[model samples]
Target: MASRFTRLTTVVPQLARGYAAPAKTVKVPVTLFGLNGRYATALYSAAARQNALDAVEKDLKALDALVVKDKGVQAFLENPTINRKVKLDGINALLSKAGKPSEVTKNLFETLSENGRLDQTTKVISSFAELMSAHRNELSLVITSTKELDKATLNKIAESLQKSGLSEGKKLLVSNKVKADILGGLLVEIGDKSIDLTVSTRLAKLNKLVTDSI
Candidate 1:
């Protein structure tokens, strides 16, 4: 299933593969919804068709890593006063560190930087990754807890969730976050569905139930 999903981006001729009868056809890029998603999706589709998805993915990952490593790169990408050429060179240099970036990747970055949307680069990468994961029928879950959970606890939660029907036949990806304001317990986000077990939410519900019972 996973292998077939990864191959979703691959175009195998139906007739050649004996999967379908021969017919005239046209090619269209797969697009993601949302603005940043659209751009990222277009870039991914282009790279996939050109067989440069791996290279582009690596370049994006490297850039994303830099944004988290050196504070300067993040600030620079988001700073509008730096000028397009400067931002392009900055990203280009980073890409160089990872070896040559695909021309399509370079062009997309340049376009976004020139339009003062470089800040969206991180989101674009994230969106692209998510798009790919989704192509593989994978969904990521963000778990917000008041305190950081140890590996044992996290794996426990993941294990339990895995047994549940939250994703059915689909894949489940988990991300953990710490938020002091939650007071206690955890909140989980699985796609658009969120399960709030935080004390804050429980209290609110209890309060509502009490008031309504009054």
Candidate 2:
């Protein structure tokens, strides 16, 4: 019996070889949704089968960097008016210039092109990175504050998180986001849970308290 992925492979001739079977044991521990997640999961399966997970990750990081740094390439991928062939060629040239493009990566690019889904390039790449982070059993710690956090303060917060049992034993991948609307203090999100310590939240609470007392 052909597995669902096997049937899917057949839909794209070039991808069948890459997505056939994982050469090594690779476990995807997380579930994702939506279009980007769907594509990223499929690519993860294909890369795992080829035992090229790291290569694919490296390719994605490089590609993502290109998308961020190069306006022309970024615009090209986002432009729906451009035909599939042109986008396909452009991606190939960009990868070639970067270095030798891995077979699985190239196959993914071609599949996206053929499906006229090049517009999903950025989201897919980001979603794949998220998968990689999950595979490493890491927690995403987003620290939002009214001002940029200094390294020392960030380190202290990370150390506290490490001991606070909030990370649930997984490694913490900490990042800072500045949101002036928070007014003051910090807003921390660890995975699905969040802590609102910002002045805005406190003010709202205070207002509610006063209103209830009236």
Candidate 3:
């Protein structure tokens, strides 16, 4: 286990070298924690130095979609029985088939494979995306409703959020998710904060108030 961790530590610098001449220091746009965060931070730093942040992000988004759509790819990454070398080769082949992915992106998957962390691939990609979004000054906004929202409605909500200072200067990447359990109204999530306006939540609050009174 110690050796595996050591390999993981060393791979980051080695991958960094494969990119452009190392910057004196690369600033991570956001703070992230945990193993996935560490890997994502390292990849972000390397990509930032290489000026390939967009390319690496594009590669990761494509890979993430592929994993979602391809059960075989999902199985390959999650399979613990497969040896590291075979996983490495499989990653290489998969990247090859994906058409020219950035070297930084390739290095990320290769390092993950070598360190037997392929099962964390999806999480790492998500972490990397968070970093990229931060880098681009983008904020995630999710609106939960009982039905899918039209694009115009989403845009209007985003604009309102921005005007209301909830979004402020950040660019909002808005998405809507349907949840019948919400009952009615919207559950808006802007970055880490949530404004719960759902009828279910209001009803629950009213019930709690009555219970306390009783």
Candidate 4:
């Protein structure tokens, strides 16, 4: 039994590396269900086995797009009164029509239905995709901005950040968020440390400068 467990562990990551899709497909990190993130790891293996990581990613992306385009769909799917059969049918129809999700994705939804966990459908799919992406060595980034950043400026930001003392020239995880409250300037957060370049902070500094001059 110990040997079998050892063997399984050895082959899991090998499969994960070979079967996972490109990292660009999933935006957020996946979180597993109760106890440990075992279910998430298993789903990653399944996708890896089928070499359907990208396809499954597309399936999840389709769902994500659907949720964004129709804000009410998530609530409707989660609503308790909705019959399981109806929900399953709706899920299948949605994925099939999208024509991008792999068989693995369909099977996952079916499993969720069997367990009466339709509410977790989106979460599970996201988690599975994230696992696959991580195994592929991709870093997910979150960016915050006061307004939409043009592509060129974004490129500059990425290039400038790569030169920062923290990055030391390594490629980084980047995402953008917009907050009007920043007033002006930019705040860059990479991992634990956040560099504040906001206008409010600048004003505080300037105020200190005047006090010091006095």
TM-scores, all models, native as reference: 0.76, 0.87, 0.91, 0.68
lDDT of 1 by residue, 1-214 (tens): 0121122223222101222334333233334667666666666656655556777788888888988899888888888687867888888999898788777677667656645677777888888787677666777778899887888887787777778887555677878999998889899887777888899888999999999999
**RMSD to the native, candidate 1?**
8.8
Candidate 4, poorest ten consecutive residues by summed lDDT:
1-10
* Comparison by lDDT, 1 against 2, better one: 2
Please give the ranking of all candidate structures by lDDT, highest first, separated by commas: 3, 2, 1, 4
TM-score order of candidates, best first?
Answer: 3, 2, 1, 4
Candidate 4 residue pairs that clash: 141-174, 141-175, 142-175, 143-175, 143-176, 143-177, 144-177, 145-177, 145-178
Measured with C-alpha atoms, the lDDT of residue 109 in candidate 1 is 73
Q: Who is ahead in lDDT, 3 or 4?
A: 3
Question: Which tens-of-lDDT digit does each residue in 44-104 have in candidate 3?
Answer: 8888778889989888888888888888987987899988778778766766666899988
In angstroms, the error of model 3 at 146 is: 0.2
Q: Per model, state how many residue pairs clash.
A: 0, 1, 0, 9
lDDT of 1 at 130: 74
Root-mean-square deviation of Cα positions for candidate 4 versus the true structure, in angstroms = 7.9
Clashing pairs in 1: none
Q: Deviation in angstroms for 97 in model 3?
A: 2.3
Flag regions of model 2 displaced more than 4 Å.
Answer: 1-26, 211-214
Give per-residue CA lDDT, model 2, range 152-190, as digits (tens).
999899889989979889999989999998899999999
Candidate 4: C-alpha lDDT: 0.65
lDDT of 4 by residue, 1-214 (tens): 0111223244244334334454332232444555124445555666656666677778878887787688687887899999978998988877776875676776666655655667766676666655765656554445567897887887787777777766644456677789998788888876456788889789989999999999
Q: Compute the lDDT for candidate 3.
A: 0.84
**Number of the top candidate by TM-score?**
3
